[model samples]
Target: MQRGKPLPQKEVAQRMEVSERWYRNLESNAGAPLTPEALIRLSTALALGPDERLALYRHVHANTKLGEPEPDGPEEARSALTHLLATHERYPAYIVDHAWNMLDCTDPMADWFPWVREPEANLLRWALTAPEAREQLTDWPRHAALYLAQLRFALVSSRDNRQLGALLDEVLADPECRRLWDEETKVVAYRQGHRFRLRLPHVSAREITVTSQVLLPAHRQELRYVLLLPESDPAPLPNRGERDPAQCRS
Candidate 1:
């Protein structure tokens, strides 16, 4: 179960067909070496989040050192971001640095990209250059402008940093980006609790809310966590003409 879920031990015991005490021991790390079969049962029983499940596995089996240092350079950052992308399989998650450079993403992101499998894909590039992405976005121009503004705000705030300045320069060099940059636009920090619609491929248009929570004191840059949550439980699309195609398209 996820960290704050209630009565996880009881739930695990019921699912595993084991007594509550035995299940509690496993969760509490009292069991010295959880057998492979036992671990699988625990993982399923607990319905653990990816991070939680991985933490449990590492604790019992890998003998790996816990919590490597925060990734310092681009390579290390990419490696860390890739792990996060892989872990959040069900949800589409992407990582951006202080300057809002898209670092890594998951397979579900492919719903917005024809080149989903490409290495080193950047969100800005996709938003501005990719025709598929443009079509997928309900309000492409507004979304593109908002992100560019966010990037500009980040650049202004972190101008002294060499890496960030270089990224800004690279983005500005693009013709479409250059055109947008020339517009005298004001950057309004996205208000908390703002939600919007996104047209994801193969899925009917869904409302996704954006929440900005901050992680701070990690050196010169502040890390912002952008969560994309479905506004409602998405109804599955009918395979063919079972439903009105026009309504579903909207």
Candidate 2:
């Protein structure tokens, strides 16, 4: 059902290119599972944002279970995520698929974690393999184990999945990741979160509270949004609002 505004089943059906009755059946959840193509069409018609589209897909997925592994997020999902990330000006934020590949990130993220801007960047891989990570992350052992456990959970649906399997192989080849993979036997469910401190180069050491959050689509749960919130608001500096007199010469 259209939650708000003037949108009706007939209008939505026309947008989705389906008959009114068919759209009503979908609204009522009386129809069969919508194909991927149908989901895309419906998503477009419903004008769903990233989170809403994800919620819609999750509703569909509950009944279907894990039928197929989604390697990447759809264009709609990507746009929604990108739009949301763009809103974070001061803090670092990014989106990664289930396999940990960086989909997109805020500009500040590049300043904080430069490695994330690289092409085909993967969160788990970089965190485990990057030399700079050792300096950035103050508590590596705990975070690394959790990262490994999350990857293990991802591997469950991807045993035979070629792309994800290849990613697993690559991360497993790394010495640190391999050790954590073998040592961390427990599965850290999505709800449970962790925190870590990051000290960026040339910047003061600030404590960051990090957490992994999920945005699941109907096809499968793949996307995870990572946010870095400061442990506490920084103290206001003296002359905070006053501009430098030298800088006013321009």
TM-score to true structure, per model: 0.48, 0.59
Indicate the worst ten consecutive residues by lDDT in candidate 1.
241-250
Candidate 2 clash pair list: 57-218
lDDT by residue (76-169, candidate 1, tens digit) is: 5445546655665655555555655454555444443435345555555666666776666667777767667655555444446786576667
Among all candidates shown, the one with the greatest TM-score? 2
Candidate maximizing lDDT = 2
**Residue 123's lDDT in candidate 1:** 56
Candidate 2 lDDT, tens digit per residue, 171-249?
7888877887776455443533455566654344345455544555465346666666666643344454643211000
Runs of candidate 1 with Cα error greater than 4 angstroms are 1-88, 99-101, 110-116, 160-179, 188-194, 205-225, 240-250
The lDDT of each candidate is: 0.55, 0.64
